[model samples]
Target: MNTAHSLAPSQVSNKARVLLPGARLGLLGGGQLGRMTALAARAMGYRIWTLDPQPDCPCAQVADHQLQASFADDAAARELARACDVVAYEFENVDLRLAQTIEQHGYLPQGSHLLAVTQQRLREKHAVAAAGVPVTAFRAVRTRRDLAAALAELGLPCVLKTTRGGYDGKGQWLLRSTADAARVPDAVFHGDAAVEPAGESDTALEAPLVAEAFVPFVAEVSVVVARTAQGDVVSFPPAENVHQDGILRFSIVPARLPQEVLRRAQKAAERVAVALDAVGLLAVEMFVTADGRVWFNELAPRPHNSGHYTQDACSTSQFEQFVRALCGLRLASPRLLSPVVMANILGEHLPAVMRHLPAWPGDAKLHLYGKAEAKPGRKMGHVNVLAPRLEEALELLRTLQVWGPLDLPAPRLSS
Candidate 1:
């Protein structure tokens, strides 16, 4: 399936009534994404429940009911389903069988089928290609021999990735040459490392990986599209993404792309949403080639790391749209209200950087996740700067990241 444009206006508002306001919304996983989603649902008069192993999870702090249990605990799953009207997940690593147990009693928008396909790189890629979207050529690797064979097929400078449970550049390796290709198995798992995750239970050590040809792209962009059970669909403008150390550093609205290429990316995202009958948000990541062709890179079947900018930049954030669509509410008008840029605060130490934030204009929006501890590469919060010109917003953001003082320029805002 290719990312094509076949969105019907009616499909834009097809949520089920079971997830309406006043209903207890059950969310699986409790990270910053869940915290944001819970915050939106609570603001709209919805009661929220979540099951997370961490009792002090950020989402748990705001939810109406928080169950401290593992995703694999059948008792926890049953309790979660019985206590809520609809069930949802904030992340993609959810177990399909466990999710199915919840769906037997409640609702999982996009449902088990979509989750099953999306939780694996191989399946997600195949599904995207089946929908008519162009993707980098990939082959599955089940054994060390399979890795060697795939290398021969896809060639060097390719990506070797776990079919399931890989995200944010984790569970992936780059095979630069034949020597590197020969070392795939050890890089994937060796002796004690292979058995290290036995306690996690949810992570399978034996799952196969997929080797894919790496595309040389000019920029990375993502499209957040929403669909309802009634079949209506709408996609927001593509957001340009930049990564530092494999973690997303910032997301800018109104990606600086050729108009035609932007249209292609948006259309491809719409196609995937419609084909999968995906309800709620689907973030389609794409690679824009030098020749201007937008190739489908990956898909996140939930609110994405990139769309976090929508919270302060657009008329409707992805969180609100997700809640509205899941509750069968009329889709809100998604209009761009400003030219904005979002910079992620990765470590807890960044709060020290806040001393310099005062230099930024008052119009800039900063949001901090209520995380108790700050660790390296941990997403702590984000600062969003808005201006008529994207460059001005970016400059103000750059100032926030500088280590020491300098003669920073004044920020200009348009009337």
Candidate 2:
């Protein structure tokens, strides 16, 4: 197997003015994103070292070396840093302290400050808004009184979120009425969800949260952009995303949007990256309001779930872009290679539908995470198919004749 040190200097030397194929790349998270990164890196002649707590994490199964440890484990992170030339992140919720620990040994593209700030909703909103990008109206809630005040200011039908560790819909609450106040107890008990305070105890974890007046959006869309050390930047095609119960269900590429609106979305993403001096993939999620106005929703500094469709649809996938950026190489052009439809496979329906999944067309691209077990609403894999048009894709999906979602009964466990 190809290893980082076995590559020629052109491939793995960080001190070199330029990076070549076969470099050793270190990844901070070992989920599906890491697995995809390792696949792309290997295709480019690079090797991978991964850090994750799971012994059988999806990415660990394929990495050249896997350091099984918590994100907060400093000694293991140092060992991982020593094994790689440069480091990149997969998910945004990585411990800030862990990031700092790794930064001491090598480099983390997008930087610790970017992750430190963007990890929290209030700070992220403040930074994005300060950068002149539009965001939903929001206020910070520090206590029960603070929550009451933010509600008074932002009003009801708003979103309540902890500042630090929330993602994919976790650590968030929807407040529709006064009765929803009961949910506040969970956040207080959970502590600060978004921003982590320095020199603070984990027990006093509950800090200020953010409440935003939720906008009624027509659809959610995202643009994945990347920046390099040389200041080069590029954006992939916009994707129209659909969500259910706060998790992404489907992402359609070259999203069904007007030309002008598409341009606006790309511009908004580019604006944020430049403002942050961001040096890796930035997934900018936005709300295209019913009125056609585009509002910045949230930002993920690393590869994002919404951009997964790009793996099959784009000439340069986000994973490749990330590899290029973290290695300080010239950025690649982001262009759609085809019109595609991508659907997420959730375990919620997997048990009931596994028997029918094999019936899907052999041509469809099916990717399953090496997760050991399945649970309701858990993401198991995804399917991407290329077709002539969006309508055709949707039609093909319907005609595929799979059973689950609506009509299938709950699966029974075998003895």
Which model scores highest in lDDT?
Answer: 1
Per-candidate TM equals 0.88, 0.88
Give every collision pair in model 2: 22-45, 162-194, 163-194, 163-195, 164-193, 164-194, 164-195, 165-193, 191-206, 192-205
lDDT of 1 by residue, 199-249 (tens): 223333234677899887777889999776676677888888877656787
Q: In candidate 1, which residue ranges exceed 4 Å CA deviation?
A: 1-15, 185-207, 348-351, 358-360, 402-415
Candidate 2 residue-pair clash tally: 10
How far residue 402's Cα lies from its native spot in candidate 2, in Å, is 4.7
Write the residue-wise lDDT of candidate 2 on 92-149 in tens digits: 7888887777778876655677776677666678778888889998876776777788
Against the true structure, candidate 2 reaches a TM-score of 0.88
- Each candidate: what lDDT? 0.76, 0.75
Q: Tell how far residue 185 is off in model 2, in angstroms.
A: 1.6
Model 1 residue-pair collision total: 15
Q: lDDT, candidate 1, residue 284?
A: 96
